[model samples]
Target chain A: MKEDYKIERVKERINYIEDVLASVAAGDIDARINSEVEDDLSGIEAAIDLLIDDLTDELKQRKKMQKEVEEKLAKIQEQQKTIFQQQSDLLELSSPVSKVWDNVLILPVIGTLDSQRTQIMMENLLEKIVETGCTISILDITGVPTVDTQVANHLLKTVTAARLLGTECIISGISPAIAQTIVHLGIDLSSINTKATLQDAMIYAMKQNQLSENVKLHSLFADSDENEE
Target chain B: MLQLTTDSNWTELGKYIIKTEHDIVQVRQLIRVHAKEMNMGIIDQTRVTTAVSELLRNMYNYGGGGEVLVETGVVDDKNALIITCADEGSGIEDLDLAMSDGYTSGMGMGYGLPGAKRLVDRFEIKSEKNIGTTVRVMKWR
Candidate 1:
């Protein structure tokens, strides 16, 4: 009868282990087997509980690590986005396209002339020309540090694109270094009008405007005089 | 419009849409972050970013804008950052001539593609006439 009682107790412990295993398989990591039962099954129950605890801890650690990585990545991305935007805004501010006079727009370009900046400069110039309907646009690159062949080509393309829109682009503020670079690169600026300084370009543009106005006035007077005759 | 074979260990860093000239700057920023993650030097970072700027500019101008996928994966047992740009605009009819320096269909400097190719360690371009164009570039760490 005592042996029979032990068998019954062992069967009960086995049943408990099966139930705990079922709970675990159902995604319950908190389930634990009874370890107080006085039998060999007690040792088995203790081992199974220890296994569950280890597995749970491992899973928790993995999840925490994954979350930390995601958060760090997000923070870095946000910081980078803001920095990039700030730099872009600074570039826009540096490449200011302003209408200094009637029918004339001036774009004062400063700093390094990367392809990206040159592209922005081109777009800003084009949009300004369209907005102000300026006939003459002056690109003053006095503050530019250096010019590579690609940068010179970008400038040439900008002038050509502006011409296509019926706006004559005058490139001024050619420093000695830039001139030397242009010569070394064998870039032809003869087809496009260029000036030494921003002041010279402005004066030339004003004079041309005055000349055209005078011609228009003279034609009007000539037509009136002919009518009077 | 473009797809890369998935590796179990590959991780996507970011994805950006190139729709305007300003977006090029954003692409540079994205690349900078990934390059930094890979511990790339300043010069290599600049070179890769310059290539990205040119390629993105081409996407905006010729491809009518598209999307770029940036990811980190193993190439030849070395960690690499791969960038792929795809567009569904009017495709390049003459791929060879288009890739050549001083060839342009619009009011561009005509040096964008060739210059970009020179800047990257690995560059590949595929296009179908009237279909689209896709460019892939990789910088290894």
Candidate 2:
């Protein structure tokens, strides 16, 4: 009779241990076999509980690391966006088209000329010409160090585009090195108006402006004379 | 487009999509940064960047869009930077005419391809009608 009773108690303890294990497997880390009576099964039950504690700690650490990595990635993306914005801002600031005279727009280009910057400068100059209805534009490249065949071609395109828009674009400040480079590259800039310095360009533009005014004045006098008749 | 088959010795630095003009600018900046990191002189850096810029512009204009892969490797026992551009656009019909200076099908002054070739140390181009075009250029540092 005592053996049968012990067998029944052992079976109940085993069933309890199975239930605790099942709960732990289902993500219930709190579940444990809290057997008060010290027996042969007690050692295994205590070991399983310690194992569960370790697993929980490991999962917590993994989650923390994941969160930290996500935060860092977000920060890097933000910084990239800021850097892109600053780059465009610099591009805008670099190409400055200002109205220096009554019918003249001057773009003083500085630094190395890349295709991107040259394209932007052309667009800005075109837009300004349309906005202000300027008759002449001076592209000062005194600060530019060099020009390859591609850059020279871009300049030619800019001049052609401006001419199409009815604005005479004068390329000013062509250093001797740049002039030699253009010739060596076999680029033909002869069709476009080029000046040695910005001062020379300004002088030529002022003269052209005066000539147009004189023509207008002459037309006005002719109209008055015909009206009197 | 054809797949880029890089040799085992080459280490790919990055790949950039060339969809818009702005992307061209960004890629140029990235190339400049990589060239600087490779300890290239300013003039060589400019040449590589400018050559890549011309290639990117051509892809954007003619191919409608493309991708460029930048790789660093040793070529002929010299440290080199390689750029590969691939596009799915209609390919060139004549290789010889396209390579010649002042022969453009588009509004460009016909300097895009030949000018790029002049700027780099080594240049290679392949194209198939209606399929695509791929250009590979290498500059030794």
TM-score list, all predictions? 0.51, 0.67
The top-ranked prediction according to DockQ is 2
Q: Is the docking of candidate 1 incorrect, acceptable, medium or high quality?
A: incorrect
Query: Model 1 over residues A51-92: C-alpha lDDT tens digits?
Result: 999999998999999999999999999999999999989877
Instruction: Report the number of the highest-lDDT candidate.
Output: 2
C-alpha lDDT values of all predictions? 0.81, 0.86
lDDT of 2 by residue, B10-87 (tens): 999999999977787688889989988999877777677777877887888899889999999998899999999999
Q: In candidate 2, residue A226 scores what lDDT?
A: 100
Which residue pairs in candidate 2 collide? none
